[model samples]
Target chain A: MDKLTTVEGRAYPFGMKNVDTDIVIPAHWLKTISRSGLGQGAFEVLRKQPGNVFDDPAYAGSPILIAGDNFGCGSSREHAAWALADLGIKVVIAPSFSDIFSGNAFKNGILTVVLPQDAVDRLMEVAKTDPIHVDLEAQSVTTPFQDRFHFEIDPFRKQCLLGGLDEIGLTLGEADVIDSYEARQAQERPWIVPSAAPAVA
Target chain B: MVKPRTLYEKIWDAHVVERRPDGTCLIYIDRHLVHEVTSPQAFEGLRLAGRKVRRPDLTLAVPDHNLPTTPRRDAAGNRIPISDPQSAQQLAALERNAPEFGVRLIGDADPEQGIVHVVGPEQGFTLPGTTLVCGDSHTSSHGALGALAFGIGTSEVEHVLATQTLLLKQSKTMAVVVDGELAPGVTPKDVALAICGAIGTAGGTGHVMEYRGSVFRDMSIEGRLTVANMSIEAGARSGLFAPDDKTLAYLKGRPMAPAGADWDAAVAYWKTLVTDDGATFDKTVVIDAADIVPTVTWGTSPEDVVPITGVVPDPGSFEDASKQDAVRKSLDYMGLTAGQRMQDVAIEHIFIGSCTNSRIEDLRAAAALLKGRHVASGIKHAMVVPGSGLVKAQAEAEGLDRIFLDAGFEWREPGCSACLGMNPDKVPAGERCASTSNRNFMGRQGPGARTHLVSPAMAAAAAITGRLTDVRELMTTQKGMVA
Candidate 1:
């Protein structure tokens, strides 16, 4: 994972509210094992409509998405986050987000910036004609039109995102502590530990 | 004196492996349930990183989302047909990965094969005082038995697979106390939907809800499971009802449960797992169960629900502009008019199965309503899918299958059928379905398919009337016929 500090690019200003995981990537696309190539399936239903912003050449390869309140409000399919990442969306500015989707987005290095609904509305307007900027270090989003909006994220998540530290990296970082705890647990509760062979052939 | 602890805090404190300076905790997981759709990439990530599963015994895998509910066996009891190529490929991937990775895989042919949530409880893999995770959001279903179970994304799934732990921030606890007894015909599903309607979908965000008070205390384990299953629908991390005698009796003598002596010790420990009296929660909501009616979701979100006797609400009735806009959009998508009676809304399909309401008890409830009735003439399709093979066999033994078949409803094999369109059983495009599933999101059943989430009896009533008829009305009519 690459460290994320600032995401500055034209944003697809699709401020559709309650855009669920089903719309992000349909269940049909979930059949494939690979996470790659999801960009093609991202917003499959919406892209079929005439002149949808996702298909417009103006915002092609945008690094940010301006969305309405309660974005990603459906299934816990990480494919929603994967599809957004594959489509080159690095930052999603929304009034609110579903907790599970926000977790998925953070884990995938996508910055889910929580802004006021008014701020998101302004960004949606600016994004139609100009690029927007998001600075994770400063915890702020700014448009080319001099509209600056501040946001707040959990300090721990911000650090993890800036450091490119995933859960695996974090767990492995505390390996010694985990090992000691496990040893104590095994000694205390032998019944919970299965006596299977270490490796199954 | 030490502060009294809520059930959420007690369970959460017990599972903490390590606490970080930033207030996040590394919680050890007791179980991990896996399915075909969301886990393939996580396993692939493991292979790419050259990591082995840290605790394969703690993980259980099954193929449910895409498994066909239609029986594939011939008259001679031999396997004849197969799933679609893509679904079959995903199942094949699970089969190929499970043995090599040392995880237990329950294939479609296995009698234990079912919706992961249903299988976990029935097989006694989900016990009290445990923390469980799965890639699917409905994993909250396990929390009904007093476990701290919730959904995780693929990355967290991989993290759990590699190390039986998750790096998580502690969620605030909310107490949802439903007092008084429910009205006659109002099931736990109605209670859950009524709560969602009261709080809105985002009300429980960033919180784990502990359902308490007299209503939850008196609810059967199956009913508790239904209520807990929809916790995610309210945007809560998970919902739990503390384990009791019913929970223990439900688990006793199951395949994976502890033996005689161990069972007594486990029960002793579980007895101490309740919330201490006077424990303060971050938030508390009290509802009168008598106020709840037979409920149904009328829009895309689960919170867009109303009593079955109510009319579709006008967007103009909402004060907030955004909420008004959302209501209008949802109404447009659902092809409904304001002031239209929900009972008058005709439906083309009826699906009575999901992780939500597909257990043997659910089947019996629906069958009890449909035993001497027939599906309406105008209905195009009606199906009853059991939750698991065990549940299916039990339903067959009780003659529920014959009752459904006699009522013009197709009695199908067990899987997550018509809940999401991952399988062949789906409400066709532009069709309206009265479903017993949790989610009623657009395209959840199929593309352009509109779903009205209902209880099993309500779904059976809809099947018999070709409309969203209130189950209580049907009950009264049946009594009158008997008189």
Candidate 2:
């Protein structure tokens, strides 16, 4: 995870509602075990259309994306987030997002900003010519023309993003706590824990 | 008495190891289902970080997404190799990773291997009053059996593999109550589609829906599974039905379920997993079962739904300009005209399987409709891919395969064939398909391949007519099922 505090850049004005993961990164690109090189496949289908935003040189390497409601609405594939990150999208502003995609974005160090549709529309318009500013500490998105919109995010997620916390490392440090919990379950909820030994090749 | 808790609260609270002041809870996961597509990266992360799985026995891995639904063996009984180099490497990664991490792998040639969601409950790995997680979105299907299951990404997959616990914020509970009897020919798929239409795609975005009332109570386990499987499509992270006698009956003798005194104790605990009387939900959606018809999605999203007797909706009818734009794009991509009769929408392909509805009950429903009928001459391709090898075997034993084959449908091996089209079963470009899968997302079946979501019986009906027809017209008996 990388620290994300302030992201300022041109945004891809993809205002399509219900933009699912399949559209972000199609199923064929999922064969790769590694996460890199997905930038080439990001929005592959939409890029096929002439004059599409992703293919337009004007918005190339844009670190921000403006989308409509229910963005990333299908599949639990993290490839969507990976592709967005690989495409240099550091922030996504949408009216709403599917839960899985939101979590995936947070994990991949991409910021998902939720604002009202009106706010998103304004940003989408400004994205064509000017860079947008997103301040995580302020929980707000601002445009060059002084348009400011506030957003809400989970405080814990905000902290993790600001600090670039490695969640597994932090959780693993509490091994004793986890062991105690397991011990309690071993006594009270034995059926929940499998009795069979772990399998090996 | 303690404050009355909803079914979700009971299950959620029981799994909480710790709760932070910020409402972040470290919740224990009783089960983790993995597939080749998602687990490879997670396992690679572990290997790089030198982090071993904390509880390997709690995890199960299998190859489904990239594996071909074609035959697994040859006449000499030797396993056939995957021709696609990329897909073979993906499967090989899982084969190496699963056992190396001490996690069970239902390998490519294993008869027990199938889609993660279908394999979980069938093997009794998914249980009531426990928390389950998977990398696949349809893991919500296991929630039909009363498990608290939801999908996670590869990053979270690695987290769970290392700690067997997730740092999650509790989701608000929503009660989806249905009353009245479902009319004949209205299967759980119809009810699910109706629910999606009623509550748009993002209706339950941050909520876990608990299906309730008489309609769900009288429903079979398979039926509940069908509805639960589509919970993600309805924009809910998970959907649940309280464990009842039906749930117990479904799991009583499954291999992974407890036996003897353990089974008795498990059932006793499951009995207590229901919502208590007078419990409250954060949101409530009341549905009339009688109002549901044989429904199908006419456009891309699951929310773009209409009854069988209805016409393709005009995007201009929507008051919201953006919604109208979305609908227009969908109509154009689907090659449909506004006000066109849904029954007249011809289908070139028919797919009757996915994690959503590939169970035995789903197969039976299709077989009942296809017994003496045949796929229409104009229908180019039709396939029935069972959820797993076991499901395929069971269908073969019941002679359902004969019915499908006789009806001009291809009977295929289990795995998520054309549902996601990650394998060789992709629908061709510019073709229309009547699918029993959950999503009708753009390019979900294939790039430029239009997919219309429907029930198994309805899909079979479409195959017979070469168009989207009302399953009721062909139904001589109720073949209601949940998949």
Candidate 3:
């Protein structure tokens, strides 16, 4: 994951509400083991249509996306987030997001900014012409026309995104704490682990 | 005085190993169910980073999504190779990674191998008052047993494998209350679809939904599993029904359930897995059970639903233009006309299997409906894949397989067949199917394939009528017979 501070670029002003993960990247594209090269499949269905925002040359490689309510509302496939990042979308501004998709996006180093629908509507307007900017440190999205929208983000996620912290590595640092917890659980709940687990697992 | 906590709060408190000042919690995962499609990248990441699984005993891996539902062996019983090259590569990857990583791999031919969600609880790997996770979205299905289960992305999958814990945040709780009696012809799947429509797609975002009221309390464990399986469709991180006698009875004699003295101790803890009286919830949705009818999704999104007796709604009926436009796009993709009678909508195919409705009870219900009837001539394909090999065996033992097979339905091997486009069992383009699986998302069944989300009985009725017909129309007064 790359350290993300500010994402400033022309955004694909797609304001389609309830745009699910299947619409972001269809199930067929999920057969790959690798995460890269999925940009070709991002919004494959929508991109096939004439004059779709993703296919328009004016917004190619845009680093920000302004979307509508309930974006990324389906499958738990991180491929949806990977495809967005591979397509150069660093920030997605929506009124709300599905809980799992928001988490997946954060893990993939993509910023999901939840703004009021009015603010999102404003960004969608400005994105059609001017570039929009998002700052992690400030927790704000701003347009070139002096329209500034403050956002709320979890402090822990903010730190991870700004520093590109590896979550597993941080948790592994708490090995002692985890071990003691397991030890306590073993005493309290003997059946927690399969007692006769001499098998493969 | 201390504030009373809901079942969700109790589970969260029990699982938190450590809580950070930013409200983040390192919650220990008691169970992890793994499947092929979402885990290959996670395993590859572990290999690249030289990290080993922290507790392989707590993890169970099964090859479900990428493996074909076709026969796995020849007449001589030699294992057959997966025909699709891509799916074969993915299945082969899991086969190698699981044993190499010290995690159990339910082999492709293992009788226990099934949909990860279905196999987890059946094996008693999922328990009450525990935290469970899987890479697939329907992992919440295990919450039917009163666990704090939710789906995760591959990144979180690697996180759990490496640390046995996830960096999680506490979620608000919502209570979906349903009172009164369900109509005779209505089913649990109908109740779930009705809830989706009531809540809209994103209604449960940022919250853990707790199913409450008389309906859920009276539902069978399998019925509760079917309801909780669609929690993701409502945008909830998890949905759960409190563990009761029904949950304990369902787990009592299962292979992985605790034995002897451990059983008493486990049941004691499970009994504590309930909401406190007067416990406060962040949100509440009240659905009268009598209001629920035989329901089916009409458009691409799960929330785009109507009763089986209703007609396809016109996009112009929506007050919001964006929502109207979304409906219009969905109708355009689904190839449905506005105001058309839902029963008049025809289906060329029917699938009665998924984590949502692939248990023995679901199979029996479909078999009961198809006992003497046949698939309509207009239907091109009809298949009933059980949730697990054990379920298949149980069905065959009870002669349900005979009924399904005689009705022109393919009695296939157990796996997530045709529920997704990953495997070879896909509905062809421009065709429509009445599927017992969740998610009517565009192309979820196949490229440009239209799907109507329905119950097993409704799917069987569609198989008989070759269109979306209410099961009530074919159902009779017999206890088990749907006709």
Candidate 4:
């Protein structure tokens, strides 16, 4: 994951708020443990309607989604992110995403871009015609029409996503800290460290 | 930099195994709780990979979703067929799966059996200063006991089962302090709803909340559980209440809890989990509990709440244009006008049971309301479920079931019925119901169903009036225990 100053990609704008995880991916699709092939299952209900948004040729294969406020406000289902990532949605721009959904998105390497409602409204309007460029390094989304918007991301998360690091990567990065802490704990809370031989592997 | 500050900071620091250039950490899960709906796939994954549960002792399983609400025995004490096949099968799967994995299962018919959320605390499984994970969102309910309890996905569930740990990112910390006293009639449901309304649903984003206030201090363990249970709705991963005597009393002598000599040791461990004085937090919000009114949600989201007497909000009042469509949709589906007073609105159904409000206390409160009078005509009402077989049996022995039935309400078997539309007890589409369940999101009950969250007593009043009515009025009209 290289630092992305700007990501110019096709846009998929969904209209409305509180677009819950159930709507993102239905419970029926949860029968499998594998995260693969979930993209097809994403928004299956919406895709069922005639002239559905996700199926629109204009937004097809788009990796960016501009959405309304209060997006993703139901259950804490991580499948929502899995489906989005599987469908090539690398960035989700909304007035605000549900906290659980945002955490899930971040872990799965989907950039949850939060802008003001007005900004989101404008983006939704602009998304109909052209690709949007998101620069993680600059913390901004820019358009061909010269529209520019700035948003904030946790500096640490930005570093992780830019470097394509997952939780395992994060842990190893702080190996020195963990090792030192363990050593200190061994001295202070010796009882916590079992005196018996380590249990069977 | 200086050591991370705040309880969330300390917790995150303690759990972190490493941090990648990306922001997530490899955090260890101290405890894992599982249920039927989310476990099947994880079990399948293990079967496919020929793997075993890594630390069976740390994992616990329970059946709540598919358990029959009906009594398990008849007058002659014989087993009976469950009224709902789906629930029966779901419980059967849990019963079969738990034994296979060598994990404890509190079966539907087991006295220890109950809603996973309720049983965890009641059995003393939830401990302070631990990272607890469940496959259900309401896992946040456990945080009332001071643990960092949160939900996980099936893959994460399998990950925890295989390694007793979960890969995760840390969350920010939010502190909510409520001052002043609650009004006489206000309940924990109202307090939680008030918080949700004030916070606008997403205010607690990227944070685990520590509830600190006089109101929280005075609240019972049950009340704290109700408040913490809805933390996810406010977009917080968990809500914590500092453990006190109430918590200890609740956990004492439970079957799974440490016995005799170990009890003191366990208490000593729990005492050390609290935050020290002068701890700092990332954000803090303060509210006066006296300002809160008995609350009910007017729309699908938990954020769409107001004082009980207040009317549905006009869509124009919403600043975000995006919310307008949802307001209109919810109003259309609920058959409500923008200015319609919630108290003046008529309701067709009242559901008085769910993991959120189903307990001995909730049942007693509703039963007190229906002691003598019958439910209003045109109102279909029921206390269709409880958390466990023991709860149902105890309710019957105490004649609470008879009181409910006498009031023209159906007394049915226990399950997560009508809460999430996972079974047969769903409200019909387009019907308005006063429910005691947690989520009120659009179509959460069923296709096009309208739901309003309320306390059990409030739900009972609605049942008796065929409309949204306050419980205080009825409580004043009657006497004896209201729990």
Candidate 5:
């Protein structure tokens, strides 16, 4: 994962509410093991429509997406987040997000900013012709039109994103403490943490 | 005085390995359920990182989502080969990866093969006072047994595989209490749907809901499973009910459950998992079970539901303009008009299986209604898919298969068929289906296929009438005709 500080680019102004994971990447695209090439299948259904914003070259490779409320509203498939990342969407501004989807996005180094619906609407309007900027360090989103909207993020997640620290890395960072805890837990409740015998063949 | 602890807090506290200053914690996972669709990338991630599973014995892999539900035996009762290339590849991937990683893989031909959610509880891997995770959203189904279970993404899946733990943030707790007794003919499915209707799809966002009160206490393990399975549909990652005698009875003698003195100790610990009398919650919702009716979803989202006797809602009824627009889109996509009675709506197909309602109790409920009846002549296709090979065998042993087959419903093998159309069992485009599965999202069953979410009994009734008929009304009408 790459360290994410600021995402500045033209955003796709779809602004569709309750856009579920199914619409993000259909089940058919989930067959592949590789996470690459999902960008081609990202929004395959919506992109097929003539003059759809996803297909318009004007916003191609946009680093941000302006969406409506309840974005990523279905399925726990991480393919939704993979598709968005593959399509170069680094930040998604919506009024709200499904918890599972937000967690998925954060793990993939994508920023999900929850702003008021009015702020989201303004961003959607500005994204039609102008680029928008999101500064994770300052916790604000600003457009060239002098429009600025503040947001909040969990300090832990913000640090992880800025540090490019995945869960494994974070766990390894606390190696000494985890080692001691496991040693104590083994002595306290040996039955709970069973011996790691080889799985049945 | 010390504050009372909710069930969520009790279980969460038990699993926390370390709590950080930023409120994040490292939670130990007791079990990891894996399936074909979601595990491929995760295994690839593990291989790329050159990491081996920290606890291979704690992980179980099964092929369900992409397996063909069609029976794989010939007329001679010999095993036939899988014909679908995509399904074969997904199954082959699991078979190859599981052995190399030292994880147990339940292949398509294995007797234990079933949907991960169904198999977890049935095999006693989903124990009370434990934490479980899977890449599929319906993992909350195991929370019925008092586990802190929820779905995770592939990245988190890989993390669990490598470390046997996850970096988790604590969620707020909400208590949903259903008091009073349920009306006749209304099942837990109705209660779940009604709750979704009461609270919009995003009602429980960022919270874990603890279902309590008399209704939950009296509910059978199967009924509790049905209700907990839909917590994700209401935007909650997980739903839980404290384990009781029913849960203990369900787990006893299972393949993986603790036995003898261990069982006694496990039960004692589970009993202590209840919410304290004076516990407080971030949000509290009370629903009267008597007020709930046989309910079904009328539109795309789970929240777009109505009572069986009610009519489709008009978009104008919504106060929010965005919500109104959503309703319009849903109505247009579902091919329904406002003010139209749901009973008058016709359906072309019926699917009676999913993680939501594919248990022995669900099968028996549907079978009891269809024993002496036949499917309507106007219906195009109807199928009954069991949740697992064990469930299918149990149903056959109980002669429930005969009732379904005798009523002109196809008896299919165990897999997630017709639920999301990942396999060949799909409702054709533009066709309407009365389904017992959870989601009613557009293109969920198949592209452009409309779905009306219902209970098993409601689906059986719809099959008999070729429309959305209330099961209670049909039962009364049949009794009157017989008299």
Candidate 6:
């Protein structure tokens, strides 16, 4: 998959904390190994209610989600990230996100932006009306009315997402460095050779 | 200047290799336990890259999911067919992969087997002052013995398997000290939930907590596990209790445990992992055990809690703008009214099992409550699922299953059932339940199913009342007068 250079879309305001992965994508929907058919199950319980956010036509196909503090609070299930991406949620603006969920979202190319609760409240208000522009390279979210909000991301994760590389890709990118280190370590610590070769098979 | 060092810091520094510029560390994984649900992809990553497990000696795999608890009856004899085909395939994959990579595996039929987290500590694979990683979030359960344990994603799993070290940012440390003794009938589950209530779910953010105090010292190893298991609910990296004589006793002669001189050496080293006198912490929060009442989650989050005798909190009581909105939505979805007495609230079902409280001790407590008693006729489903096969066998041998079955509870096989509806065990949509699981997050039990987190004894009381009633009140009534 190619890296997402820019994320531009409307934001849905879900001002609630502890939005667990189970709620994002229920485990029953995880019967399959494929990534497809996930959007159908994205927030199925939430969508069951009449006039819920996902069901409301006003916020249909919004690519941004403005969430309250402690979003994505439970489970390390990557399916949550997959479901959000499949549903076109490009940026999640929350006061905070669970560490596991944030890591998973980063790996799956979803931008989890941490804003202060006050900033989140403002975005929640603004998302009710206008689209938001998220420029990954610039690391900012801009309102259609021309207000800009800057955020920070781990440079390593930013590089990975921009390059569309996973952990393997990150390691492979430094393959030469790793190989050279290994060659040097072989001379310095020959006892490490037996273990290293055993794992290379 | 005073240098602040908490038990968490003591453990972290003991395990640290070298700090990097970015604040993350290349921490060595002393133990890596994997289960069926989270290992397949990591194995696939390894296959794609042509790499074997970096430190097979430190890695262990176990089969818990899709392994039936019951012995399936065939014409020949009783046989459990790995009853679910997909799980069978995954188990077979592990069987094929583990040996090929020189990793040890505890198969389903192995007598030393149970849930991966359960068996790890039981077999002494997890120890104090070590960093442990698993692909499951509840890996934090191992922290009860003062180990630094956390869950990682599949990619990270692959990273650890390939390198035996993970690049992780160090977390801030906090101390949660509990003074005084727990009242009678209150279990570790109650104490854990009460702490969650006091801390408000996100209180432990960005921190790793070391549980201290006299109360923790008196708690059994099982009780300490219960307390540490739910640290994630409070949003901490993990929770820990310094390994003591109790920990050494539990690990004394278990399979895979260090033997003879090594065992003594390991314990001596573990004793030094404790926080030294005059150590300081980044944050400190103290709780009076006497003030902790049996508590349960009244709303979507673990922090949405109240004492057993308290009423549902009105949204008007919350000052946070977002909390009010959330309480409103949760009340609307739960069909609950503000200021409703928690004791009077009726429930449609009761669930007593999960990694949170599915050990033998929890089962025994629930069975004692239901002895010679029947569940209320209105209570539709009162179910008990064991945490693992070993737990089921232990309970059945003690006739705990009989107590549950006679009380109108459906005793089902274990595999994280009803904990979050991962399998066929689930409450129907819109039904309310008193659950013994750690999480009571929205839709955690099932779609639209309201789950009130309670201790096993309280869940038993709810089973008898068909409503959320205080176990203390039930005991009073059982003494022939309603308190």
- The 0-to-1 C-alpha lDDT of every candidate, in the order given, reads 0.87, 0.91, 0.91, 0.75, 0.88, 0.77
- For model 2, the superposed segments whose C-alpha errors exceed 4 Å read A195-201, B476-483
Report the TM-score measured on chain A for model 6: 0.84
Q: Give the per-residue lDDT digits (tens) of candidate 3, residues B1-483.
A: 767889999999988899998889999999898888999999999999999999999999988886788999999989788888888888888989998899987777877878888888888888888899999889889889998899999999999999999988899999999999999879999999999999988999888999999999999999999999999899897998899999989988677778789989999998888899989999999999999999999999999889999999999999999999989989999999999999999899999999999999999889888888889999999999999888998898999998998999999998998998989899998999999999999889988999999999999999988899989888863543433
Q: Which stretches of candidate 3 lie over 4 Å from their true place?
A: A196-201, B477-483
- Two-way DockQ contest, 3 vs 5, winner: 3
Model 5: residues with Cα > 4 Å off, grouped in runs: A48-51, A179-201, B73-81, B479-483
Return the top candidate by DockQ.
3
Q: What clash count does candidate 2 reach?
A: 2
lDDT (tens digit, per residue) of candidate 4 on B1-483: 454355556556666665657676667566688888777767766777676786577677876655555666788967676665655555566678778988777655566667888877766677665678987788888888777898876656776776666666677788989988988778888888888888867778778999998999898887888899989888887888877787788877765566565667667766655556777778888989879877888987888897877889999888756578778877776778989888887788888877788777778878877788777787855554765555677888999998988888887766677787666667777888899888887667766678999888788878877788877777777553322
For model 2, what is the error of residue B364's alpha carbon versus the real structure, in angstroms, after optimal superposition?
Answer: 0.8
**What is the two-chain DockQ of model 1?**
0.47
* Clash total of candidate 3: 0
Per-candidate TM-scores read 0.96, 0.97, 0.98, 0.85, 0.96, 0.89
Better of 1 and 3 by DockQ: 3
Sort all candidates by DockQ, best to worst.
Answer: 3, 2, 5, 1, 6, 4
C-alpha RMSD of each candidate structure in angstroms? 2.4, 2.5, 1.7, 5.2, 2.2, 4.5
Question: How many clashing residue pairs are found in candidate 6?
Answer: 1
Model 2 chain A: which ten-residue window has the lowest total lDDT? A192-201
Clashes of each: 0, 2, 0, 15, 0, 1
Model 4's CAPRI class?
incorrect
Model 1 / residue B108 / CA error / Å: 0.6
Task: Give per-residue CA lDDT, model 3, range A1-201, as digits (tens).
Answer: 899999899999998899999999998898898989888899988887899999889999999988889999989999999999999889999998888899999999999999999988888889888999899999988888998899999999999999999988999999999999999999998788854432222
On TM-score, who's better, 2 or 4? Answer: 2
- In lDDT terms, how accurate is model 3? 0.91
**Which wins on DockQ, candidate 2 or candidate 6?**
2
lDDT, model 6, position B353: 82
B51-169: candidate 6 lDDT, tens digit per residue: 87867877888866445544434567555565456656666777777887888777655555567777777667777777888877778888898789887776678787887766677
